[model samples]
Target: MIRKINRIFQDYMREKRLKIGKNIWDRKNKEKIIEDNNFIEDNNIKSILFLRYDGKIGDMVINTIMFREIKKSYPEIKIGVVTRGGAKDIISNNKNVDKIYEYNKKTSEVKKLAREIALEKYDLLIDFSEMLRVNQMMFINMCKAKINIGINKKDWNLFEVSLKSIDYHYHISNLYLEILKFLGIKNIVRKYDLFPTNYMIEKLNLKNKKYVVFNPYAASKHRSFNLENMIKISEIILEKNFDKLILIGTKNHLSELERIKKRFGDKIIIPETENILEVVELISKANLVVTPDTSIVHIAATFERKMLCIYRREIGKEDKNSILWGPNYDQARVIYVDEKVKNGEEIDINKIKIEKLKEKIDEI
Candidate 1:
């Protein structure tokens, strides 16, 4: 009941704010002239700032991939990124990013951070955050960048250069690359390039096992897999001749890990730690990784580890090139669980086909 009410309230606020934002944008568009590609090239940008406010795992992955291509075009350019604290670990080691700025979404730190950004004197600012949040709009307007590029949303007139997608059906990596294309960056390369440290790899002692890692938790309940399904999947992995199974997440997932362990004691390894780099190192050594659509999956992609990614139907819209986003450098496969109903009721675990899952496991 509480979840239903929260969803209703959230939808109401979204619609209300979107209406107001559209009206503001319409008024602004009538007065300002939209610039063209010629104007962008004339600006001569030397430094670029990328912003990812939504801070989802996919968005960070797209950002990291796009930044690599952007760096290749302008090797001498300085690139910076601003994201939430949760994504700090993913973006911290990104080669294209010279500096990383983190901000709390709930506090005034966003505004304070924006102020500092306004003083950076950047040549271009790219807002990869698709949402039209008021604070982000304010920050984009304040930045000293000569060329500002972003999505052509209802409030797109506020940006000097913009690219519009047909709908939300487009892949996020392509969407980000579209903005780069608008800025005259044409040599596009789509691949995940995250380099893990030797220190991180050494700490996990990952060389000894033919193992697969599983991360069944997500920040939002709506995106998480049912614990029962997670347990069944773990059991299938153990039965399929795998040596070990590592479960990684925060302490909140300990109960679920314990539940899995109870069924297959000592075979399931759940390491408790607040350090994300350690988790990355552990994931790097895995022979295969089974995870929900989360940041850990992005880390696994960096190491080119074979992956069995289970994505919810609703969130699957964001995964445009499903196979491309998988372990691109090595063996990987993506299994999308479409909406399935049983006995006139929406069943969560039933959405994933166990037989198809086993077939994919056998292929890997």
Candidate 2:
């Protein structure tokens, strides 16, 4: 099958890239590999830079705790973040971040950004990349910070303070906080903070009407609820304790959302908006948030909004996805489609029971 061939090709490319990366890193930093965990412990840090170039909104939302807590604990330490795309938007309003450097996958751009970072001469640099890709290693090596910290990997001799990987299942946000814990930042608060924008404030005008946000789409189709199930869920929510149902998704989902819009007409409210922050603002003020496995879950968790999330897991098997990246806030409920799935197959989220979903809506 095409999928199997693509997987094989991807694996081949990954191994090839890893071999090339190790060769390049060995030649580039032959005499620069240092291991000193005590450098940060001895109060010798003044400035810190974090590499968060992965452009997922949920991942960036989780990283918010790092920026805020570090600034809170060490008021004098200058904080800088390297990010791109939508990930940049999440922290654009963060007060704790003193500077942000943007970079992309292009070698020229990354090299230029690395040179710029080296000029800053940060006392500490942190790389949270679990996979030590060639470009990531190239950028990290080029940064030339005094002390580099990151999650430990087996044979990669890149970071100076390589903290051991977290062994137990914890919310990813808390797992990231372990880096701060290693740096002696004890006054950590396990919560998320999002700044309100004038654009978001001006755009949201529900006028005190109670509304629930229903996001039935995900980045991948398999993770999204099917149209039939979406309608059923919408009907269930509307019949329960909500005044209006606000349907939301990205521009790519407009046609499908429009189709759903035709079914309910005036009862369903779809706000015209631009950008993810607007969607975040929409979730912020909602009465309750209902979504599939998507970044909306994280946005809802940020505000501790009452949330009902849907996901799929193989029956009688340990669901690692839910265990690692489920909603972190209280007042959150998740409905998992527990059915047997064969190997190399994606679980169908539409298989979730409508009765169970309705039960959750009533409880919320």
Candidate 3:
């Protein structure tokens, strides 16, 4: 198809640009930053730059906790975040981030942006993604920071310092926090904070209510519940005596949501905006939240709210099964369908029974 050909052409161009950009930078080995008693003390680290350019909303949301922990570890240290414009909200309001440089993807002038960030002369730069793609490593070299750090990998060879996880059995957030712990950040707290503006609070208007939230979308079709199954789950949850139940997702689901609203009465509400903060605000006020494996589940944990989570079987080693992302909090419960599947077989959301979901909801 023309669309697939166009996609391949675009990818080729991006790779070409990345290769050109890598050559433009001074790609040579430098001194590696290691964990020492006087690592921070000797280097006189005053400010740090964290590079994570993944535009996915969920990745951005989870990194907020990492940013907060870095600030808490050193009250006086300044923090800088470099991310895409689409993902800026995750770190925009955090008091810990003294500077945030967002990449405008429509007109990407990364070299120009790098020149400006380099002028800041950050004491340390860390790329958390550890991805070796052209865009991932290009800016780290261009920044001209004193000590560059990233996760250790064969292709992540540009940074002066690289940190890797000693233990692989931890959630993504904890895996990221290990970078700080290696740098000797003492008493790091694993907490997430998003200070909502007064307008945001008044917008959703679920303030101090005994309502619950239902998010039926995930990153992929296989991960999210289908409309028919979602409706069934809603019917089961409605059997409970909760105050109000809100149904929300990205604008892609608007048509389906309208159908659900028509099928069910006014009890199921829809959000006016697609901005993720509204979801967080709703989650913050809700007595309980139910969602498939997505950013909503992570946000629920960030707020320490009671939640029931559902996830599909991760087909391969890197698919991130429930054991990896399952909530560590006592208030959280997860149902992993087809937990024992070994090969990369995609499981349908409809395979989960209504009675099974109701049993989980009844416990809540």
Best by TM-score: 2
Q: Rank the candidates by TM-score, best first.
A: 2, 3, 1
State candidate 3's TM-score: 0.86
Candidate 2 TM-score, true structure as reference: 0.92
Clashing pairs in 1: none
User: RMSD to native for every prediction?
Assistant: 4.4, 2.6, 3.6
Candidate 2 — which residues are off by over 4 angstroms? 1-6, 26-43, 198-204
True-vs-predicted CA distance for residue 355, candidate 1, Å: 3.1
Deviation of model 3 at 348, angstroms = 2.2
Reference-based TM-score of each model: 0.81, 0.92, 0.86
Total backbone collisions, model 1: 0
Q: Which is superior by TM-score, 2 or 3?
A: 2
- Winning candidate number (lDDT): 2
Q: Which stretches of candidate 3 lie over 4 Å from their true place?
A: 1-26, 29-34, 105-108, 154-157, 165-167, 199-205, 314-320, 339-345
Task: Count clashing residue pairs in model 3.
Answer: 0
Stretches of model 1 off by over 4 angstroms after superposition? 1-41, 166-170, 314-330, 340-347
Worst 10 residues of 3 by lDDT: 314-323
Worst 10 residues of 1 by lDDT: 25-34
